[model samples]
Target: MRARLGGLPTFVLLVGAAYCLFPVAWVVVAATKSTGELFSTTTLSVGTSLLANLGELGSYRDGVFWRWMANSALYAGLGALLSAALSGVTGYALAKYSFRGRALIFNGLLAGVLVPAVVLAIPQYLLLSKVGLTDTYLSVLVPGVISPYGIYLARVYAAASVPEDVVEAARTDGASELRILTSVALPMMVPGLVTVFLFQFVSIWNNFMLPYIMLGDDGKFPVTLGLYTMLKQGNTTPALYTLVVTGALVSVLPLIALFLTLQRYWRIDLLSGAVKA
Candidate 1:
């Protein structure tokens, strides 16, 4: 019985792993091929044009790829930080405090999470344009900071991780509510907050529609939009395929590194949350 049960999970695990890694494998192999070999050769057969492809991509528009990467880092890093802070505060408040309209606020934030990014893109662009904020860094960063899902995660983390007795003791010792939140609760919530930050970081990093709509200038484009524009043009100029593939390879690196490094924190905190529940 044990062996059969174990084999069942192993088979499922292999299938799931293959489903996830198949695209990554395809991208890595396809990226090594030249334009002529792309459709001509087998999808997995690597061509000898990787270096030349990289060189051509580098020379394209005087190295626009790096600029887009930097812009993406700015948006994701700063935006995630702000999102984490807001989520921690708002989540803690909802979990710890009793007040009127709390359910209303929580429900509203939950609803906001279900709203698609494409739905807000045009309206956000128009609104920012009206205030002369369109085409600027603030236009992208500001909207990104207001993540509803982050708040929801933050509330869950705060409630699960933070002990009510600890909070009561801190209050009895005359710590201000803000101080209890900042020092006592914040430290306990670190793992969950990191999870929230990572999620928001990826979301904003992968986001294309909003930035594409908001910015007319190429300089301000995030990696996703920048790669997409290259892709769109690549349909006409198949040479841009090299840049698109190489850019995709580069863009995926940081996220992988981050997930590997921080995965332990997630596991540990997750176990803690589960025990509390």
Candidate 2:
């Protein structure tokens, strides 16, 4: 009975992995197919038109597909970087400082996390519209910079990884608070911050609603929105199905690469934290 119980968790994990990866697997196979094969061939079967499909996708609207790709990179990459920085600073301050209304502020941010993103997104659009910022890149980029969840993670990480004595020592040596945070605390919190950055990046990358609500121009559309547009249009123009599939496949590669590259930092940070503990 105990053995069976232990195996159950593994079974659940495998099931969950398959549930998530099944679509990805489908896209890989589907992207290779020609429009005819997309409908006619086996769902999982490989097709020969991968290169041809890519070429077609590139030619669409004078390589707007690549433009979408660049837009996604900019939104996710730059947004995540700024969000991580703000999270790190905010988190470190919350963890290290003692001041008035600190708990209240933290609690408010926690509540912000609980509020549904859709709820906030609507208000964000309305507010940005008031300032003549709607339909602009800043509309998307600015809101993503302040992640309550990222700040929360950074606080937890700073609390765990940054020692009070080290902070005091930096202060004793005449380092400014900003200097201490940047030079001492930030490096220690890299692992957790990287995780935060990855989360924000993926969230922003996969985010359809915010950009969908914010941007009016197709040229400024991220891959998620761009693919959504393609998928929507595919209902009328069937050939676009292949382009959409290929774009979906191509779009995930950068995220996969970023995750793989930064994953090592997570391991190293864990080991270092363990040793410190």
Candidate 3:
């Protein structure tokens, strides 16, 4: 009887999956088409010009497309790593320690999470400009290193996942606080930190406004802004449409690779700090 009733839920899930994936499937198919075929062919039909499109994208603007990719990787990768590290240490402190101003600081960081990024970005740009830092890589990177949500997640995970008794035992064995955090607490927090990293990584990768407002050099533009400029230019130069489409298809691969690589950490039980057996 349960098996007989599973069809409706299965149908609903398949419908949801298709709704999410249809655009991706269209992009995969559309990127393969030539300029003429792109407008001429059915949305789902495969075309023969994938390599040609890729070649054109590579040659565009003195191969600046690849430069955009590298900048994105640098910004997102470095920013996420730093954000995760800072969040881990900060979260661990908030979770494990009791000290003066601790609650006040944690509450302030929580309030920061409620404020939208757009609200803060303009002020950040203006302040950085006053110091002569705008338009540089540091302008983008420095702002991304602090994630209130990451800190919040880190705090929650540390409180719930990290064993207090294990920390006490390490201290009793003459381990320094720094050593205990690095060697013991961090390992226990891996699954949660991976979550923080992915969140920050995707947030930084897809971030457009901060870089758009901060950096003037095309050399420093990440893929999001790069593709936006391409699409904007496509209105005058219709050929750029193909490059944008192809670039969109290529850009998603890194995120997919990241998800696949870090997915195993999610399977580890946060409470038990072990893989389900």
* Highest lDDT model number: 3
Residues 1-277 of candidate 2: C-alpha lDDT, one tens digit per residue: 8879879899999999999999989999999999999999889989999999999999999999999999999999999999999999998888889799988998899899888878888999999899899988888888889999888878878888899999999999999988998899999998889888998999899889999988899999999999999999999999998999899999999988887888765432323322332
In model 1, where do residues sit more than 4 Å from their true spots? 265-277
Q: Can you tell me which runs of candidate 3 are displaced by over 4 Å?
A: 266-277
Q: After superposition, how far is residue 259 of candidate 3 from its true place, in Å?
A: 1.5
Better of 1 and 2 by TM-score: 1
Per-residue error at 179 for model 3, in Å?
1.5
The lDDT per prediction is 0.86, 0.89, 0.90
Error of 3 at 193 (Å): 1.1
In angstroms, give how far residue 81 of model 1 lies from its true place.
0.9
Model 3 C-alpha lDDT per residue in residues 1-277, reported as the tens digit of each score: 8987889989999999999989989999999999999998888999999999999999988999999999999999999999999999999998889899998998899899888777888999899889999999999998899998888778878887888899999999999999999999998998899999998999999999999889899999999999999999999988889889999999998998888888875543334321210
Candidate of highest TM-score: 3
Tell me the TM-score of each prediction against the true structure.
0.92, 0.89, 0.93
**Candidate 3 positional error at 158, Å:** 0.9
